[model samples]
Every structure is written in C-alpha cells, then in structure tokens.
Target: MSEHNTHIEEHRDDEASKLGMWLFIFTELLLFGGLFLVYSIFRLQYPANFHESSLELSVTIGVINTIALLFSSMTIAFAVTAVQKKNNKLALRMIGITLLMALVFLVNKYFEWGHKFEHGLYPGSDLMQLLERGHHLYFSLYFFMTGLHALHIIVGMILLIIVYFKVKNGSIHHEKYVFMENGALYWHLVDLIWIFLFPLLYLIS
Candidate 1:
C-alpha cells in the first residue's frame, strides 16, 4: 500500500511539472506572435522597401543555419527516443551533438551580423545611407526579427544543457521523462521558427 501511494505521488508531480512547462511555452508563443504581427504590418506598409532590403541578406549563410537547426532538431528527437528506451549513453551523446550544432548556428549568426554592421546595414544605424541608395526598411526588419529569434536559440541551448545533466545523473528516466520531452519540444519550436524565417527572409525574392 505504501509503494502504491508513492507511485501515485510521483505521477502527480510529473503531471504538474509538464503542465507548468506547457504554460511557459504558451506564453513564449504569444510573445513571438506579437512580433510576427508587427512584422506583417510593416511589410504590408512598405512591401517594396522590404523586398529590396532582403536582397542584402546572404542566402547561402541562411541556408547553412537552416540545415544546422534541422540537424539539431533531429538530434534532440533521437535523444528523447533514447531516453524513452533507457539508453542513457546514446541520449547523452545526442544531447551533446545538439548543443554543438546550436553553437555553430550562433557562430554563423555572429559573422552574418558582423558583416551587416561592416556594410552599415544595422537597425537604426545609417538608415539614411541605405534608404537614399535604395529601399532598406526590409533589411531593418530582417535583422531585428531574425536577431530576436537567434536569441531564443541561445536560450534553448541553455535549457538543453540542463536537461543533459539531469539525464546523465538518472534524474530523467523512462518513467519520468516529461522534462526531457518538453525540452525537446521547445527546441523543435525554435527550429521551426528558423525554418519559416529563412524562407520569408531569403527565398521570397
């Protein structure tokens, strides 16, 4: 009877934790949705300017980042699967890979942003120079929106690191894997955001 009581308590705790994570995720979506609405309104107001600004972006770099995020998403999915199967070693390795990929994506973003700065194309900086030459409002939105998304990726990586340690120490097992699953879900959302950002910012031309 005591063992059954303990099991019930554990299940209750797990469900509560999962609920909290989902709530947190919902809030994040709303925040990002607000930004998306702003972008849409601005794009409609200045369609030509936005298109011209987007031309300054490096499609090649954007493609590379997309591929990296996709690979990281795959790694996280496999990590969750490994944990479900009770394969701790494999799960650890998968998490490590995902972290590395996230780092690579950030590094690429650093260079991309640096290049923009060198060319005098950042938000609210030398706007006259770009606008006088041609339309640049699109590029302004591009940098701000995508830059915010990159920040989210960094935050997601930090969460993944925490989950990695928990799984390594047996805090996350098949019976108590909600934390890992939620973490993976968040990471996938980050990847999904980038997927949409890439096409909208790069390929729409």
Candidate 2:
C-alpha cells in the first residue's frame, strides 16, 4: 500500500461518526413516538380521567425536574465546546456539573415515585383495583413511560462519566472530540424526551 493510503487509514472521520449518532437518535425518537401516539389515543378515549390523573401529579416537582434537566443539557453542550477549544479542564468541570444535575433529577424521581406508592397508586396495587378503567390506565402509562425515561437518564449519566475521564486523559481533545459530541447528543436526547413527557403527563387538561 502507498504511504498516503496508510496515513488515511490511521485517521477516522469525525463527521461520519456524528452522522451515525444522529441516526441512532432518530431510532430512539421513533420508539418514543409510538408510545406518545398511544398515550394520545387513550387520552381521547378518557378525557376526563386523563385530566384528573394529571392533576394528581405534582406540577411543582415536575417543573423543577424539567428545569434541572434543561440546565444539564446546556452544561453538556458547553462541555463539548470546551473540548473543541482545547480546554480539557473546563470540559471536565462541566461534565461534573452535568452529572450532579442528573443526580438531582434521580433524587426527585425517587421521592415522586415513593409518594405515589404511599397512595397505593402503583400498578396492581389495591387502589389501582378500585379505580375505573381510564384512571387505571393513566397510572399504568405514567409508570411505564417515566420508568423508561429514567433508565435513559441513567445510561446518559454513565456515558458522560466515561467521556469526562476520557477528556481528562487526553483521549478526547480538540482535533478528535467526536466521542464527546456523541455523549452530548445522547444527553440532549434525554432532556428532549423529558420536555415532551412533562407536559404530556402533568398538564393534560
């Protein structure tokens, strides 16, 4: 092989990698899109139930979590920018802050779920047995969708942690920061999903 061909083989395409991440993100959107469609149909079937069920949800906590996730999304974006600017320390700090925000989100979710359980609102509970079909379905969907989103948040947090250490070790730097970009993209998707979820589950009226 020619020396030029060998050199080209050694370097990867960052734009191509980003395109791959975008494609993956689309698949995720489609998956959630189906769930949202189902939720909409059910709401139409039981308009009053959905509205009342949404009222049971703590709007104050939901709004707080929304703000936290949105802020974390910005932090991760800034971290990626710092990497592009060759400021690895700032990138690490940004990632740290983003991770803390994720922790806060999870803590809030724990308490929120706990409160529901205390009220016997979880799936298959005695209270669930007493509720009408529409009311029962509301709590069921609420648990299923939010549970999946929290799982995504956990995955995003793990990705951010890995990227933070990689940046600290100089593996992800200005000229080669595609991994950081991918991590940021995933985090943004997590936040975006929650943006849709908050209103769907909390403000249905």
Candidate 3:
C-alpha cells in the first residue's frame, strides 16, 4: 500500500513539474515577444537604416546558424523520444549530436561577431560614432536580441549536459523522463526564437 502511494505521489509530482515548466515557457515567450515588439517599432521609425544594417549582416552565416539550430532541435526531439522508448544508447547519441550542432552554431556566431569587430561596427566604436542614430539603434537591437538568444542557447546546453549525466546514471529513463522532456521543450523554444530572429534581423535587412 505504501509503495502504491509513493508511485501516485511521483506521478503527481511529474505532472506538477511539467505544468511549472509550461508556465516558465509562457513567461519566456512574453519576454521575447516584448522585445520583438520593440524591434518592430524601432524598425518602423528607421526603415532605411534598418534595411541597410540588415544588408550588411552576413546572410550566409545567419542561414547556416539557422540550419544548425533547426537540426539541433530535431536531435533533441529524437533524444526525448528515444528516452521515452527506453532506447538509452540512441538517446545519448541524439543528445550528443544536439550538443555538437549547438557548438557549431556558436562558433559561427563567434566568427560573425568577430567580423563585425574587425569592421569596427560594435557600439562605442569610432565607426558607430560616424553612423546615423538609426544605424546605432538597429545594431543595438541586433546585439541585444541576438546576445540574449545566444545566452539562452548556452543555458540550454548546460541543462542538456545535466540531463545527459542523468541519463547516463539511469535516472532519466522511459518511465521517468519528465526532466528530459522539459529540457527538450526549452531547446525547441530556443530554436523557435532563432527562426523568428533570423528572418527579422538578417533576411529583412
């Protein structure tokens, strides 16, 4: 009887934790959505400069990072599915692939930003001093939005690392995968944000 009650309690806890994660995700959506609204308002106020700054960005790198993030999202989804099916090996591989892809995206971002620095486009640079206010505002938004999103990606990777260790230790298996699911959900959110960000900050430019 005690064992049965413990099982029931565990199930309830899983449900509660999942609900909590969803609430957190909703909060994240609102946070990014508000930033998007700001971006739109500023873009409207400085359409030409925004377009020009957008054009200066490397579409190639943006597209590549987009592809990398999308692929990572898929791998993490597969990892979650694998864990649900009790296929531990496949789950670990999928998570590893997801991590690798995330690293690739970050490396590309590093080079892209470095290229910008080489051209002296960062805030407070002499180049920025020469540019119009609209350009400054555009780059400011660009840095803030992308930097924040990148920070999320790093955080997601850290969470995945913890999940990976849990899986290794048999703590996150088919019968107890709520944590894995939450991690995957967070990663998917990261990918979703990049989807919107790429087009808005790169293609539209």
Best by TM-score: 2
RMSD per model, one decimal? 2.9, 2.6, 2.4
Which stretches of model 3 miss by more than 4 angstroms?
1-12
lDDT of each: 0.83, 0.93, 0.92
Tens-place lDDT digits, model 2, residues 54-149: 999999999999999999999999998888888889899999999999999999999999999998889899999999988998999999999999
**Candidate 2: residue 127 Cα off by (Å):** 1.9
C-alpha-based local distance difference test score of model 2: 0.93
- In model 1, the Cα lDDT at residue 59 comes to 89
The digit string of per-residue lDDT tens for model 1 on 10-108 reads: 334767777888898888778777867877787788777777777877889989999999999999999999998989899999999999999999999
Clashes of 1: 1
Highest lDDT model number: 2
Q: List the residue pairs that clash in candidate 2.
A: none
What's the residue-level lDDT of 12 in candidate 2? Answer: 86
Q: Between the candidate structures 2 and 3, which one is better when assessed by lDDT?
A: 2
Q: What is the lDDT of residue 81 in candidate 1?
A: 93
Q: Write the per-residue lDDT of candidate 3 for residues 62-168, one digit (tens) a residue.
A: 99999999999999999998998889999999999999999999999899889899988887889888889889989988888999999999999999999999999
Q: What TM-score, computed on C-alpha atoms, does each candidate reach?
A: 0.87, 0.94, 0.93
Model 3 lDDT, full chain set: 0.92
